[model samples]
Target chain A: MGDFLETDEKVLISLCKRGDLSAYDRLMQRYEKKVYALCFRMVGNQDDAADLAQEAFLKAFRALSSFNGQAQFSTWLYRIVTNTCLDEQRRQARRPQLLSLDKPLNTEDGQLLLTLPAEASDPLDTALSQETEAEIKTLLSMLPASQRIVLVLRDMEGYSYEEIAQILNINGGTVKSRLNRARARLRDLYLKKEELFRPTVHLNRKERRDRL
Target chain B: MSCEKFTKNMGAYLDCVLSGKELSEFQEHLSVCNTCRQEAEELQSMFSWLKQAGELTPPKDLRKSVLAELKKEQGRKGIRSFPGFSYAAPAAVVLIMLVVGNLSLLLPLHVSDAVPMRAAYQQESGTVTPPADAIIYTEDSPDNEQVSEKSELSSEVERNPSPRLLVLNLVLIPLFLFFSLRFQQNRKEAG
Candidate 1:
């Protein structure tokens, strides 16, 4: 993958400027997953994430001519995604909140916490992992949109502090501080749910066998 | 580093953003201090779990929908299609209308037309008679005499065109008033 990506990005960008949809498609395919992931985690919902991602790509296409190649291609893309996601977040905030509307995430073990429907299974994780995933996502939603976005990019996306700052148009120090604060809050929330981190006890021989 | 300092710089240190010297110093301190080491481990675990959360894929239909919207936007780029069409269109129309409306004035009027108009104005005014010394320069005059005669004629026009200015003002003031009143009425109608 790295070898395929090693071709000069400027060449791809120029091709895109010349209306080469294939080159633009390649660029989109390359970053779509990461960008969507960033949007998904930041917005805390899948549908909104998809909308923001598409809008971000369209915005990037419109701005391709104005792109003076001053910044790296990925950096420019990240800025577009960040701005689009933030706009969506603002719009979502204006709309009425639909509390208790979404299905509870599924967990691994048969021991259920929040019940989920038979459908809507995601491929990325097992039931238990999905539960944990959904829990963290909910916790992240408690943060201000700015802090949530910075933390998502910095932590889950593994973006460097400078990259986060560039994407968010903030200084690196602000990125670092916000990440610290966000992570601290996350840790507090995680520690509050002690059962997730603490080892589970097996009650029966059958249960122990199932765990094994 | 004390626990306080390590905690304060934990975000920076983990991001590998501290100065090289400061990083080495922090590491040197970490080698001796157990509390900072433990804090670093906890921070590392926090970020590790976060990273492990992984990505969420967007819906398959989003690309199609957005591109469909973009295709609609292509037509809206009409405003930029012709580089100077917006500016040139109105100007060309106005210029053509002006040339067509006043083509007679732009082309020279014959002496017959001027003589009749002058005679009619004289009869109508009755206040001033044509000057006795009004010498219309003839083509038979010598070149130097023609030059002097033209200069004298120009000087006479220069001294006397104030009457033309006054005549223009007299004709235009009522026109101005009529248009001004019409403009105000149109504005009121619009409001």
Candidate 2:
């Protein structure tokens, strides 16, 4: 967040409008990791996040010419990313079958959780963790796409309340209320899991003792 | 304070949204309510931890894939603006107008000219008069005669259409078809 102001996003945006690919590339280089990370946290998969990020950048590039200087370029880009992710999520939700989360065994996480592979003994926990990720992703999937987006931009990406409101075309108050509700819902969901909830009790004690 | 009131203001306070006297009131409520304070503390920790989840990068091929899609769209746009397809509409309009204008000009002749000219031909050449059957219809007044003759000629034209008009129709119909077909082809190609 601190270094974000150092890059002069407005200058990069002007360069982008002039069709400077290198400038656009520089802009992407600056924001892609954060954008992807936000999508990954929301959608909970590397591939989906990558796809969402690409869509976001492409949309931003196409729309850069029309961008008024009222808002920060990163804010505009965040809006595009948020919309793109929401669209993907809505499309996924309409499909009734469970989506495949399978990845190639070559990746580290994949290597650890290849369900059909013979080497793994505790594949059930591995599969359940993957399912946990999927359930969280699905619960996020269930949120009204707009509210989920405000949460993702504000809570996950660490965008300010003002920025989230501008991106979502809502007022600051709505953004605040929605984000608060989203956090409470997520906290409730996390509490429902015994393993995580019990750990929270221990963690709370440790945190309280540490503060003392 | 009721739990609902504390809960509602709790979100606002955590985001630093409460202002002036509201902040003081919320703090006073918070000091009195351990449950609300604990809830606020938990929310703070949760969001703070979510923030620290490290940055993730998208795979390399994603950009290339999107750029290629954009290039395809640009190419489709180019195909739509191809010259023949652009000109077909104006060309068809001009052709139809030329045909219609030419057909409209073959109006009836005046009876004044027809009858006088025929009579003059008969008298000067000392030829036999035209038969009653030859004058199929007659007008009562001179002016009416002229008008009727012109109307008769136009009726004749309607009865027996002109070869020139036929030729113009022949030319335009194919050109129109070709233009329409070309437009359809261009659309298909663009798609």
Candidate 3:
């Protein structure tokens, strides 16, 4: 239980492997938020995300010995989290529950209302309004697991193509193709609603300020 | 580039992985093809927005809860990994084999060979046929009476049955169960 306040991740991992629980705790604190974010986007809810993140950490702990430091610790850990979430979705898929198909989408306005605001505020704030983020999460959940994982890892989690390929255990080419398909599928789903396209997405301090 | 080819390459194109020749061809197609251009723009925006959606902070107690859960799980696995595998198990077989090895000396030494225990039960009087391979291992008594009853021979058989098989099975089973269970668990969740 030594103070790991300034310990490097590799040292923390080595300590964890040698049975130091607090070292593992330190390692966990470093990535818990990121892991939680991945789970949240993958599952589109906080509760399941929390559970998945926890399960992923436990898995990372158990499998710590085999983590040879070949990949970055974060990448290895993200792989576990990604797989944990994907496995859970697969389990859920097996016992299909009645879905609320008619659940109201957060995006109230249709495509007609899309326009750049005259006064450009923080683009992130405008682009990621609570409803917009919620809508994005919901739409992400709709994608098939294969496509969803690639999309989430690439688009939301910001893993590199090579990193994503390693995380999913696929080749880089496959990662690109899957990511492409995931993006395409997501686009189709977005267009299906036609209202999900937030007006702020493309309005980068320039024209297209009002609906035609 | 054909529209289909352009569509397939949209990912590479967006990623800026396309080379100069390919990039020029792709832009040329996009320049002329409205559908391909619009599709690329929309996906690009959508992808960027989703990226911008950004990370959310987990609940304060997430680490606490997960740590608590990890503790509980370790407790469970701790017991299984303890010095012995205990717990009233399933497929339980209560083998109550009475040790009758040394007790054979107390009885009149009537050792029966090849004949299974059903022998020595002659119904008629004085018409008893001794088992062909019956040997006398003990020299306790002066009168080595040739025992003539079924019960005596049956008791004799139980006292001298093979010790190796029972000891082997008993020693091997728990060890087998412990290792197999551990192996199965590792296989179930291996990385």
Candidate 4:
């Protein structure tokens, strides 16, 4: 955190309204991580998440004048992120492209970026963990966009029901109902993947035996 | 709470958003009912997994790229709001209005000619004169004097068609347009 990070958001917003680019940059730095995190979870793709997050910040800056300070700036930004992700999802559905080949495959020096190499020594453990993570992502992608957004806001992002409703521009009851349905749907999907859970069960049993 | 009600409220309960009394009842039910307990545990486990999976670091260059994009956008806005450029639209409108107004003044004043004055004069002469009471404007009447004054003013207008009002309208139209555009820009910025 910098000096601007310690400054109040209202002060920063005021400065941004005055066309202070530094203030806007500081605002971006403060919320960029959380915004990216939300976008990544919603889209389940890093490239799309990065694009969506960037678009969201740009939109926030453009529409900063319209921000009436009714909601927290973070909430407003989250709403933008959520809407951007949803729009991206809708666009992808219409076009149905498997990969964004137009995007660069590597850095300028031909160095691969975003490679998540496993630190674990056991290849089987690494493979199992990656598979389980992939399976969860698949299950999340299976949900309707609305339900998935509510689920991500509630369970993943730890937003309150009221905050999720405000962000989605829906009622609190609707958020709760959607969250419930999303949880139930996710549980059903997880149950269907019984094999994915078997390794964890075995690991737990083996650890228990070793402790005994 | 009944098992059915508990089932409906299970998600909210896991989130700990249930009302206090409802939460207590839910906990009591969970302690007693194996089915509800298992269901709650599964939901909790699923949520826990989602939380863990959702924690991802954004790319290192995202902030840099976003800032660069913001700078570009700001530059575009700066160009738009440049003092000279911002006033250019209104200035052009004023110039156009001035040229049009001057051209209109140079053109013949055909509006007076378009009126059927000969027919009006013939009708006034051919019509029967009204009775004294019906004729509201008597010779000694102030109304009669006012009618003569109005006719004299009309003749004066026919002799010299002044473009003062036309000039005023031309000036006002551009002024209105300029102010309206400025107002709209201000509103856009505020919004």
Q: Each candidate: how many clashes? A: 4, 0, 0, 2
For residues A53-165, write the lDDT of model 4, one tens digit per residue: 88898888888888988888888888989999999888877995554321213434442222233323345443246655655666677688888899888887788988999
How are the candidates ranked when ordered by lDDT, highest leading?
A: 4, 3, 1, 2
lDDT of 1 by residue, B8-116 (tens): 7877888777777878878887889887788678778767666556456667776667556656665544543466544454455545644554443423333434445
Tens-place lDDT digits, model 3, residues A115-141:
322322246654446656656766787
CAPRI-style grade of the A/B interface in model 3: acceptable
* Candidate with best DockQ: 3
Predicted model with the maximum lDDT: 4
- Report the Cα lDDT for candidate 4: 0.71
**CA shift at B97, candidate 3, in angstroms?**
8.0
Instruction: State every prediction's TM-score relative to the real structure.
Output: 0.60, 0.60, 0.68, 0.62
Model 2 clash pairs?
none
Q: After superposition, how far is residue A29 of candidate 3 from its true place, in Å?
A: 1.7
On lDDT, the stronger of 2 and 4 is: 4
Name the weakest run of 10 consecutive residues (lDDT summed) in model 2 chain A.
A112-121
Better of 1 and 3 by TM-score: 3
Candidate 3 residue spans exceeding 4 A from truth: A1-7, A101-128, A195-212, B52-54, B73-191
Candidate 3, residue B19: the lDDT equals: 84
TM-score of 2: 0.60
Interface RMSD of 1: 4.7
